[model samples]
Target: MSTLPRSLLKNLDLFRSVSEHDLDTVLQIAQTMRLQAGEPVFQQGQVAENFYILLHGHLKVVQTTPEGEQITVRYVMPGEVFGIARAMRRPTYPAACIAVEESIVLSWPSSEWDHVIARNPQFAFNALQTVGQRLQDAHTRIKELSTEEVEQRVARCILRLVDASGEQTEEGVSINFPITRQEIAEMTGTTLHTVSRLLSSWKEQGLVNTGRKRVTVRRLDDLIRLAEGQPPGGTAASKRNSVEPL
Candidate 1:
């Protein structure tokens, strides 16, 4: 296990607010690990022995449905802490985390968590906030699944990806990594064909551009308007109720 750099340690949510002296203590108990794309950081139901703070790259949290279909729960980005089964008191992971790109992460043994939390109560508070945000995102996704049309769901998903990991380019805002139509289907509870068709329509309308593994939003405002079921230039108040807090 490589030692974590002070810069990376300071950026982690779990360690960000700690005093430098306290951070040094915490760093002494942590180890850094690297994962390649498609690597499994941990498997669902495996003993939960460690938690992680990602320093670079992306991870996808996924659950296997009863029917054995893989459902994407969320994407974990750099500076995010994951594998919190220890905090939740689970003996094993509820979902599997797989690296979507070459990634670097800080790992702390589960046994050290209690000590760190005791020494830094703020760690626990930050963890709770992270979990709460994820829950809110899940709720928003559930609402989209239950009430929104396929087009609306895709629009929302694209917007969300942009928010999470979009990069600004001359073309527009592009989702920073590759994602498949099948994955989009799983995330939105729709069919791949539906997603592809909607994306195709958006492409024609100058709303988006798609390639084999990426999608770029050429006109985000148009997609937002479509999400609200309103015409372009609609008032924020008119769409306020329709917009779900993420």
Candidate 2:
């Protein structure tokens, strides 16, 4: 058994729906682990013996292509669960998980997972919902990559990140954490030069403001226009209404 702070324990999804007694029982089997930025929590094909909930900072899920190029699959933020291979009954991890920032995580051994799920059907239902959402997001990204231009794909990627983890400021909505042009390129399957050029163009048009490692949307309308591949005007406004707000 490992000791964990009460505050962190309270926020984890697996514990949230359970009764107080169950929550305490679950915590008795949990361990807290700390990871440094750029540290590998687990490698591809590693044994899936434990599941984790991110308590702080960010994690990147990545896979390498046959050609040896690394591609980012998704960014996992605090309060999100990762290492679900055990729960899903996979013997090994499908993708590698790395800390994008210094992070803290709560881990439960695979043995406890079966007991928890058997006792709490809600946990199983929630896990399925999370998987479904991820599948939808993957499908959307695949469609964008197949059909959209590099600029539009990049725009949509940024918009999704902002919606997931953005902080509102007087200037605009800032992505909650730092991101690099290289990471953006990897995510959108575009060249670094292309990302830089497109972002510069948006800046010139007053659509965004870029800092050293941050991006803020200044004119959301203009960004939306680029994302939809539409000329700036009435068509963009109509599209905006249909887009769910972040």
Candidate 3:
């Protein structure tokens, strides 16, 4: 049996509606896992034996192409449930989930999925809601990739990260995590060189402050304007300078 507090599960979105009795039932099956940065919780195409709910820290879901290139699909925050290949009726996971920082997760055997849902209606509802939201996000990403310019995509990606994990600080709104330019490239479907150059230009224009694996938005309004396809400086020449051939 897991030694973690029972109240911890209650705080998670997946278990928020579950009653005390149902929570106890879930705790009986859950196994706690600790992971270091760069460790994969599950690899792409692995048999999905367990579904997990992150208790703490961040993770990134990545999919590898046949040509061996990796693309980041999304970032997972605490309280989010993941790795439900069984629920999706898939034999194996479609992507890999890797810890972006030191993290903790609670996992239950895939075999127990039906039993748990059969007994806990609220949990079943919550699980379905989670799956629906993810599908919507995936569709949104597909749309962005199909139509948006690289510059707009990069700006929008940063904004999404900020929405997920941004923290207010003396240095404006900080992303509050270690995210490298290469990872940003993967998320935005651009080259690392392109992300670096755009960031450098934004910095010179006093829109952001960046360091190794860190980014802080100093001028949120200007960045939003750029993301919306408007010139940051409200001029035609500024718009021309903002976009470059990839």
Q: Which is the leading candidate under TM-score?
A: 3
Kindly list the per-residue Cα lDDT of model 2 for residues 9-60, writing each as its tens digit. Answer: 6566655677767777777888888999889888988998888888888888
List the candidates' TM-scores in order: 0.89, 0.89, 0.91
Write out the backbone clash pairs for model 1. none
Tens-digit lDDT track for model 3 on 1-246?
A: 679888888877667778888789889889999999999999999999999989899999999999999988888888887999998999899999999999999899999999888977877887898899999988887888899998899999888888888887766788887899999999888899999999999988877789989998877767888899888763555433442211
State which candidate, 1 or 3, has the greater lDDT. Answer: 3
Candidate number of the best lDDT: 3
| Candidate 2 Cα outliers beyond 4 Å, as residue runs | 233-246
lDDT of 3: 0.86
Q: Which ten-residue region of model 2 has the weakest summed lDDT?
A: 237-246
TM-score of candidate 1 versus the correct structure, residues matched by position: 0.89
- Candidate 1 has its poorest 10 consecutive residues by lDDT at 237-246
Rate residue 165 of model 2 by lDDT.
Answer: 91
Clashes of each: 0, 0, 0
